[model samples]
Target chain A: MTGTGRETTRGAARERGSARWEARDGARRVTEGSPGGIVLEIAGLCVDYGDGPDAVHAVVDVDLAVHRGEVIGVAGESGSGKSTLAYAATRLLRPPGIITGGDAWFYPEAGEASSRLNLLDASAETLREIRWAELAIVFQSAMHALNPVLSVEVQLTDTLAAHRPEMSAAARRERAGELLEMVGINPDRLSSFPHELSGGMRQRVMIAMALALEPQVVIMDEPTTALDVVTQREILEQVIELRDRYGFSVIFITHDLSLLLELADTIAIMYAGRLVEVGPAKRLFRSPRHPYTLGLLSSFPPLHGEVRALSGIPGSPPDLRRVPSGCPFHPRCRFSLPRCGEERPQLVAVSADGERRVACLLHDGRQSPPAELGNPDAGSVPVAPMAAWGPDGPDRSLPPLDDTALSRPEEGVTPHA
Target chain B: MSYLGRRVGFYLVTIWAAITINFLIPRLMPGNPVQLLIARLQGQGTLSTRAIHALSVAFGLETHQSLVAQYWHYWVQLFHGNLGLSVTYYPSTVVNVIATALPWTLALVGISTVIAFVIGTGIGILAAWRRGSWLEAALPISTFFTAIPYFWLGLVAVAVFGVVLGWFPLSGGLGQGMAVAFNGTFISSALYHAALPAVTIVVTSMAGWMIGMRNMMVTTLGEDYVLVAQAKGLSERRVMMTYAARNAILPSIASFALSLSFVVSGAILVEIVFSYPGIGYVLFQAVQNEDYPLMEAIFLIITLAVLVANFVADLAYVFLDPRTRQEA
Candidate 1:
């Protein structure tokens, strides 16, 4: 992906300053690879379910970044904590799901660190201001996520009223109708309560409400998990279409690897609450670096290819309370080594250009990546381009990570005033 | 059929059944109201057979008519609102006796119930929203009050606040010989006498509402919509009031409507303890004196009150919750 490189970073950030979705469609190509492209950055994020020794460390020392106008899909198993990471980063985690440590910096100016808001350290008022107006989230079950007593128009207009105080009631109603239309629903159904709508329509209403304020980042947590295939695909298309048209970043989280492989620009594979691999979607699908990612890829039935016996990874997800020491995945790893059980491997660069990284001992350079994982350079399944926006090409603007950015707290991320 | 129409039909059938049962129970029992009246009057003079017959007809205890014919007459009288005469208050009709007591009961129990529900439900919402607040800490104390029999509490209140402290009147709906008019003196004296009983009912019953509402609120707080509302960055008050409590209060409303219906019956024990001259106190006197006509009238009124209240509750559910508005 050709990002808006360094020279135009300041210019691009200025041009996109608080512009509504209607005003800017031409300047939507400012996706991240360079420092100017990153919209959200998390460093050393750790989340726990409870306090003291009995606590289940749901998300541990994880680092991720979502570039402007990028779709970053997070794929993990049931207990992988992808949803927890999203909730913690957004400061939406309920009690007993505490952010023990983390630095989640939301950069409205792309990569300008000075303007970034520290999500975890912000006061409740600041967090409320940042939420919905800047960052919106689409929850898993729309039926339960919507107020049953309220009509669709009321819910949509409520969000608008809370943040868009300058908007008159008439303007808010008109915008809500427009949002429903944008999400492929008839505007006449605006007065219908949630129970009055079908499941797919309710989900579409949820999407419309989330996008009502034209937020910069929309975090979708398994939004289509309960939907049928056709409805899921339709919602997914609308989501991508909305993201493209608005130039906002999306954090799409799900357990379906095949879905993420088809949707995301960059896919992050998590296991046992830790990221096991991070790479371009096509490259990761064709040439998985981590054994867990390989296991996940093999488990999904290939849409086009010679039929093969689908071998699911041996053992269920680890009990978070009793997660095995060292590499948490070693107990179920197909390519486990004695050393794998003794020491945990950190996610590090696997490609020469630092475009892909994996947390596996085989990819640590002491030994070659196992033949079972397939050669990265060799031709594998010829998958289609990531999404309608096309593949994220060589992302060379990403700087090589050192120990500081990986495990250390970010500098200059003080709490918002 | 439409929801309102269906509910009204159902309640009509229920009322018919209740009135039929009320008619049947009195006839099924031996020794009619006229016989009991005659037995008491025998002390004044030996009544002639013709005088006995006239008394029986006046009390609607005509034995010459068949039961079916008597039932028909009962319905006819009920339609005209003729509830017969009270044996206990010999000169007054059943309707007159109830009319005198209804206002007192309605004012005392209805006001006390409404006060309890409002204060209790408000405390419940606050306690659940701020789970560990001082109000929540005080919940157990309220529960203790609820566990204590309200009549016992009323008696204790009478002993302490009425007898010892002399802060309020000890009993009755109004001061003795206070001319029960709409004048300021009568109104103020009536309120003064009602103070102790109202407090007893409010303090004891408010806890049940609070506990019920608190439990519902806790469950509702975990609903996905509540979390979504919070995530929408709305103020805490908006989330609590509109999303959480709005949904949580539904079940409480149903029960509240039921209690509102029972307000017509009054708190029997509390009224007896205070000798509060409400329907409950009158009903107690009727039963003690075996005033069958008065008892039957009061029972029918209480049953009809329940049916009407539930119908009103159904109408409210349609407004408050869209889910219930759909066709079954």
Candidate 2:
């Protein structure tokens, strides 16, 4: 038995080593015969926008794991490098915005075995094949993204023709109609031009297009930013409902923490291109460990909490061109210690849970209590009053109560809001 | 409805202003054309003061005449299709001289302008689509030709192709002994002689359209709708022609209309250099002999043509773009 245990340990180490090596070259590793839950694993990802002294580190030492049927929310203010992480993962980062290091592995679920594919090092042809097949994206500006001259039917059918050339014209049309219905849009409106649709309808059409291919992963970048509150709620509700029925993972990037808490299974908080803290949605919202995460939480009101003005984090995100030394977030961190300015903190597990990890000096040791996280005066950090917050506030009211809460699975409660 | 009515009313008032200015400008020039005509008719001898005054009154050239009376008489003469006699052309009426020359100028310059616009816009669209290719290689040559004066090109063409090679006629609307009649033979012969001058105009004017269309196409390619079209997986050719080319070509349409308005005036120097019996050649004779009525009639016709062209261009905006119709 001891010999068998040793052999298994050695085999596991070798597999891990191979995974690391594959990741270093920007490729995905497909592991076979593993319990099929995890769909994407991103490890040690670093992206730079330039070189030498002028280089901007857009994503630094970031790591995230998205499981099957789980919606992962990535929250950060603009320039905090949240969107860069998404772009880098998809290999869509253009020149001057380079992915210096990292591995984005996609594991497609198949019968009893899982197939892992490396995204970063894949051939252009392979990447093209995977695009809109296994993964898709919905950009923020729906009006600008949709061609004004094209009808909604053409826009949706176009993707099917490109990606699935074998499908007949009638089949493509039928699929498009089904997608529109799935996204809660009337089938009749498919023949209308983009200008004829409302902002919410346009965004829903974008969602339908992204979902048309039945992709395993969908990344949405501030999908509701251009919409009014009522429409925003309606669209988001439809998105959650579709995600539940489709059984696909999602990478939802937004600046609003409240919305993420309600929609995500796990949440990752980014500060200055670094993942400061990541945990289950409940734990991260209930008690965040990183100073930036704390600042982000206190800076906004909870949806279930009292109605009050929103507060905002002090200081702007550091200019990536000339980032501060050591921890990039140290300058803006209220709980920054002398060590924080001198040494960058590596992401470490907060407990033996393996589910929660944070990159902050305060969480350096595994045994540190949750209450002892960050500086003692971190809670009292000076933030602008909620009324003084800019247009991009995190404390907006909750989406309407009719939409089912797809992220919450522990409680048998049907979604009331 | 009210807004459209107001716009139409404004355009009518503008047309009226243009006509009034056209009528007033030639009369404002310092010259007693009636006295000059009387002196010439009297065998170049000095006319008596009473005879000169009587001739001035009869011609409605005296300052004592009411403005309304002079304008009414001018309108009557204009309406009757009479432009008086051209002093330079002996006893020929200005209208007759113009009538004899108009067709030659229209056939040559009008056809050249249309051909230039079509070829230039097509080449420009290709250049924009195939950027960094040999299609753009011809741009510098076109620019060089455009910069050279039309008259200089006419002289060169005549010298090389007519004088040296004897491939085309040197001067006149037809062969030297050809009869001047309105027949198929005469028209075809005139067209044969007009070829070299027409080529010069086409080559010179083509450059402006090419450069303008290319620049506009580049700008339109950068618009979001073009990018959206590309993202939709449309073929590169479809995207280029439908999304980029259509929008870029709009401004060229207005410019082409403006160019057409100038064709009737004709290129004076080119006509003189080739000795083509076009409107420009006739206008030159009028100017040299101080024939004010001929000059005024040509100027008035050219101005009215330009106004009508501009009105048509404005209407075209509604057809080419649906957004304009909505706003209007």
Candidate 3:
């Protein structure tokens, strides 16, 4: 209801060709169901590390949005640049990481009359005013993220004291206590230092601090990667519960595809500094159109199924310093063709009425995709479609996915490390 | 045991060990202070054996007694506020000589040190926080002064400010024959004379603190908490001071404690250059005259001062850092 106009502007920005127009039309066809509107809209965002010709393109031509009351999970390999996208959008990226191009429009009230601010272009004073009051971030590893010297109470109340100067000290303290309680931490431990608390409790304190100002959007940069499985589950559950209570949007960045499958309403798959595919979580899980997304989904073990062998993608994430040409993932793509090697594919809609969009040549209809491409039941089916492979199609025997890709899945995500 | 309790006990044992070593040093040496005094007295006039024995007992040398008995007598005399007589100062007692000089050294070095620490650390914080500012250029220039010896710097200061400029007194703790009184005239004269040495010490020493603090601040700026503090929408000054500098200053506090302990030793070369009546100047005269009693007293005080200062630092550390407050 509120983001209808945003659709048209976003469509107008990408005036590349007829294919892009069709993609724009396809985007317009998807039904808008978000309750409020788009809380944030990022289009054609680009981030580069360093300057001049030697700069590494960390985030390239990325477009993502966080609708009000929605969870958008960004899943990727360790160097796939998912975290870079979030930091660039939030204007939290440090030196050497510069936003080369982009527009990140934030709608604080998420309605027609709500004022929109481009975070990348905002002044220092304006950015500071909007940071914790309208958007907040919970960093990875609360142990290092929290000030070891300050008490939990001081840290939680710091945001309030900074943004809301009119509030009395007593009121701030009471609100800090309420925040700790909301995160299931006892308010009596507010005076304790970070070292005095357990890792789980420290992470809970971080969550409490992030939500202290009740910001409209929260960016969790792998908040639970340092935690054990039990604590991670508990924290994630609490996050979801809090989201429901506050009705705020979350941009959850993690490498764990399995966790995102359960938590995120929509999933954006990134590979080699670009978005490969984006779709509703259930649709992406059941029928991933992009080969990279299919590989990631199959890489992790299913939650409620019999034990089975799993195979990851054949190669590691490409080095940003020397990213592969054409489709960056073509080197590891199982359904790659000659055209995929020469022609760069843009993220366009898979079908006219569907919400799914993919950036692989197979989905572009120049060649026939594998018959089992979208079938959830097709476990590790060989995908050597000759028509798509062109005249120089390989021999019948194709290299199977090997153990080299298995190690990539186990590499943990450490935000800003 | 509590942390303070353990620290106190440790310091007490250290003091006892230091006092025993001070008592043994003169006895262990090839010649004795009493014999040296007797030799000087005999040169002036003939001395009888009984008179020599009387002088030795008066000085608490206890030549005829066993070493154990003399050690016991030494401890008894220490508790009675008696430290024998200073051979260099003749009739003056060692305690009186030290008391006369302690305040001058304390007032000059102690105050100058504190001023240097505050100024250096302040500049360091500003330099690191506003890197590329003109204040950052001050770092290498100031640090260059640390390479110059303090006594040499004192001489150059005297030649410039004292001789060429004629703005301040050149030497001594006070003007010639000025009585040690608490009157305004006497106090102002003393401060005027102390200005050169104090400036020299501060110029040379402040650089060390500035460099240390600046390096530490750079490291702490990269810490995750500083970034998080910035993200919390804190004002630039608040984030830089409360979060960044607050943690960076911890190591400086520990170093400050060490600096305090050495304050009693009095900047020996600078005192010599100024010809100031401080413990360092007195210690130099005692060593040259071989005034064993005076030297022993000063050494014992220096060791005990170090122990006490470290104990005070421990208390401050426990207060500042919660990690150290836990019971061991």
Q: Each candidate's TM vs. the true structure?
A: 0.92, 0.70, 0.88
In the range B1-328, model 3's lDDT, one tens digit per residue, is: 4777878888888888889999997889897787888887887899999988887877887667899999999999999989999988987999999999999888988898898999999999989888889989998899899989889999999899989999988889998888989899998998899888988988999988888888899999988888889888889998988889988899999788888877888998999999988999999999998999999999988898788788888888888777787776
User: RMSDs, each prediction?
Assistant: 5.8, 12.4, 9.3
iRMS per model, in Å, is: 0.6, 3.7, 0.9
In the range B1-328, model 2's lDDT, one tens digit per residue, is 4545665787788877876787788787787678568757789667888977876654557788788888887778777987666666756777888888888888878899999998999899999887889979889999999999989999999999999999998888788788889899988898889899989998999989999999899888766566545534455676788678877888897888898888888878878988988888988988887777778778877887787777777777756654454443
| Local error of candidate 3 at residue A280 (angstroms) | 1.3
Error of 1 at A86 (Å): 0.9
**Which of the two candidates, 1 or 3, achieves a greater DockQ against the reference?**
1
Question: Considering every candidate listed, which one attains the maximal DockQ?
Answer: 1
Candidate 2 runs further than 4 Å off: A1-70, A84-137, A146-218, A245-250, A274-280, A306-312, A346-357, A366-417, B1-10, B32-66, B69-223, B248-253, B267-286
lDDT of 3 by residue, A116-173 (tens): 7778789999999988777888888788888888888888888899998999999999
Cα lDDT of model 2 by residue, A326-358, tens digit: 777888776677877877665655533445667
Decide which is better by TM-score, 2 or 3. 3
| C-alpha RMSD (angstroms) for model 2 | 12.4
Residue clash pairs of candidate 3: none
Lowest summed lDDT over 10 consecutive residues: which window, candidate 3 chain A? Answer: A394-403
Candidates ranked by lDDT: 1, 3, 2
Please, what is the whole-model Cα lDDT of each candidate in the order they appear?
Answer: 0.85, 0.75, 0.82
Q: Which stretches of candidate 3 lie over 4 Å from their true place?
A: A1-33, A111-114, A306-308, A375-417
Candidate 1 C-alpha error for residue A175, in Å: 0.8
- Name the better of 1 and 3 by TM-score: 1
